[model samples]
Target: MSGKTVIARFEQGKETFEILVNSDLAYEYITGKRKDPMSVLDAEEIFKDARKGERQGEEKIKKAFGTTDMATVVDHILKKGDVPITTEQKNRLMEEKRKQIIDIIARNSIDPRTNAPTPALRVENAMNEARVSIDPFKGPNEQVEAVVKKISLILPIKFAKIKINVNIPPEYSNRCYGILKQYGLKSEEWLSNGSLSAVVEFPAGMQTEFYEKINNATQGRAETKILE
Candidate 1:
């Protein structure tokens, strides 16, 4: 008696084949080891057949592998034999998503016309406005300065870095700086050339007011760089 094991199969109404292998066999066989004379296909042969011809077509093979589509189903069972991404990877992916959300919030603020500021920008503008409103006086210069100060102040503290640019005349510049300074902004680095160019720091938020302000302030002399 041979100490060989047989792998038998019956396909409902179809013909059955028996595969056999020695119990002590250490190497895999490309061709199936058959104890019965009816075996006609090896493991490679079956797989090749599964990939081609009407024997194992697209729909039939997918059904066998229990997948909805031929793309992943075929690859999953034939190549990897399992889904890859683990729970840990999923958690890390979620963390990355959360970080992205935080970034968006920190960088952008709402539109005054729209009332929807990004998280970081919102914090800066709101805080700056709150600080400015406490001054017991307000004007065009103070209003503009208040908002700019809000943007400038929040950016450095929350995001740690970013630059803002303001272009106001010598007459208005002094008042602008005064308002910003009054809001606890501490830097002359924000003041630019003699042509009313003041650079402040903040995150990348939509500068709706900045755009409209430039056209109004210098009568279109100042141009804002908008990133699409």
Candidate 2:
């Protein structure tokens, strides 16, 4: 034990578990920087009360987790459990996740006014201006929309993409399906007449080229409509 430890707790219906583990290591392990959950442990033991060092029993462990194997139990505890962290650590992780959200928006979005890619710095400034709060523990993809919505109130921003509903004749559907997948096939369905009805999206800048390629591939037989 390094003695620099914190209690990571997990609780649910009939399951109350805790472990005393190094705080920094548990944080890294939960965020995927550290793979070996066992390595994060200060002691290879599960506790009903970590502060008191009360060891939980095997039958209860097996009942709660479906197995009492120490490695498996530890993995579940470290992952599903809450590892209390310092405010400084929480702030640092929040900052990193904020940068990820900004990068994603800047890469795939644009200023609707001129259809120009919004600079990352501009996005960051708007985020600060909007006072967007980011969740460090939540994945960036999950938070992008909410952050974008908040930032959009302060900046003229929108994702730079065009969605097209395309209908392909049976002979060409199979061939064009692969092409649509390459673009960004959102939703697809087969018609009663053996045709393919699908929606595909691509970067706005590729609008002209996308139509040309699809038209040529389907030999002018594919029908398409621009979605709002």
Candidate 3:
């Protein structure tokens, strides 16, 4: 397996220099021994470490110059595509990820309404209403477009396209539209009651699943007149 050599450049006060290495040379630089070319990820890391060593050597050259060119120094560094990761850097990333997961698990454990229980349960219930708002520029097909776009991110479908009809006061029509849009539905003006009726489509077929999610999210106030 052959790959191109890497040249990493850096600058000192007035002089610019580079380190040139083939895959074999990078392996030796990283592991202190030569080995065959390996995965791109491994090779990249090795090259980054070698570049660090190269930078140290270049620093000595800078002392000879009375003034430093920042732009030239930056350009030299950019020529190297990979960034080195130190052990401390890796550890810090891992710790951040661990904290994020712990937070999510804690959040999902609670009961939102009663607040009587763990955050995990509340989060689980909340996920049902977690929706991607439909973009209006797509036109009336906004709801349809949303389902197609975001279905992959949701849990496996319980059913296909459960329909819901919504009616809201003419004054609050926009607010209702916003709410429906939250559930990935598109709202259009309806002649009846001058109140708008929006059709919300969901992948879940059962009325129970659809209504339960809608009621929970809208606080049982979002009226839905299911039309078959």
Candidate 4:
């Protein structure tokens, strides 16, 4: 595994530093799986000999990073150096994220002018028309807002946050509870009369489909109120 380690090089002014980290850890850091890339470095072991006045580990780290401070090395790795993944791999990852964003928009957004859910294709087209760029390193949730804002300029769109209060009779509560949970239940309670009441929030684009699911589960026995 040591032989498969990745080297990150950083240079400032006339000085240069090379840091070693495991290939897997480097990939994770580059892909946002790990928040800090330096955490992957075995800093403790590198400083272990320093505590005993040997300075072997410290010297080696200093030689690699120009300083023994792991934080500085981590920052440099983040700001510079190419990610170890290939361009094709990065493109595939970005494409997957782009699909996820499209799915989210289709499920949660609507055309304000028409008051109807936006079609997935239209949303995708709008994204392209607006020239929205999805950050390969960011999760869909983190990047969707900006993407939506850009697309909205080309289409009359809005991502609606809606809340609904629902009540289910005892006979349907057990079966319906699971379905409701998938829609983002915020809070739930059981009534003394053996009923289930809950609050759920989800994208308004899903309202019709969600209502149909709830209605079918409860056989029209569920009462739902859209809370303003």
Best by TM-score: 4
Q: What C-alpha lDDT do the candidate models reach, one value each?
A: 0.37, 0.83, 0.42, 0.74
Candidate 3 residue-wise lDDT at 177: 64
Backbone Cα, N, C clashes tallied per candidate? 12, 0, 12, 0
Single out the weakest 10-residue window by summed lDDT for candidate 1. 23-32
For residues 1-228, what per-residue lDDT tens digits would candidate 1 score against the true structure?
323432222121232212222322201111123332222223321131332321334444434555544334322332222112335533543444334433454445444443333554355355545553322111122343344455554443222233444556554555455443432332444334554454554433534434454456455565333222
Which pairs clash (backbone N, Cα, C closer than 3 Å) in model 2? none
For TM-score, candidate 2 versus 3, the one ahead is: 2
Candidate 1, backbone clash total: 12
Better of 1 and 2 by lDDT: 2
- lDDT of candidate 2 at residue 61, scale 0 to 100: 88
Candidate 4 local lDDT, 58-165, one digit each (tens): 555577567867776565554464335556757866888899999998898878887677888999999989888877756798888888888887877887877899
Which candidate order results from sorting by TM-score in descending order? 4, 2, 3, 1
Error of 4 at 118 (Å): 3.2
In order of appearance, the predictions have TM-scores of 0.23, 0.59, 0.30, 0.63
- Candidate 2, after superposition: displacement of residue 127 in Å? 1.2
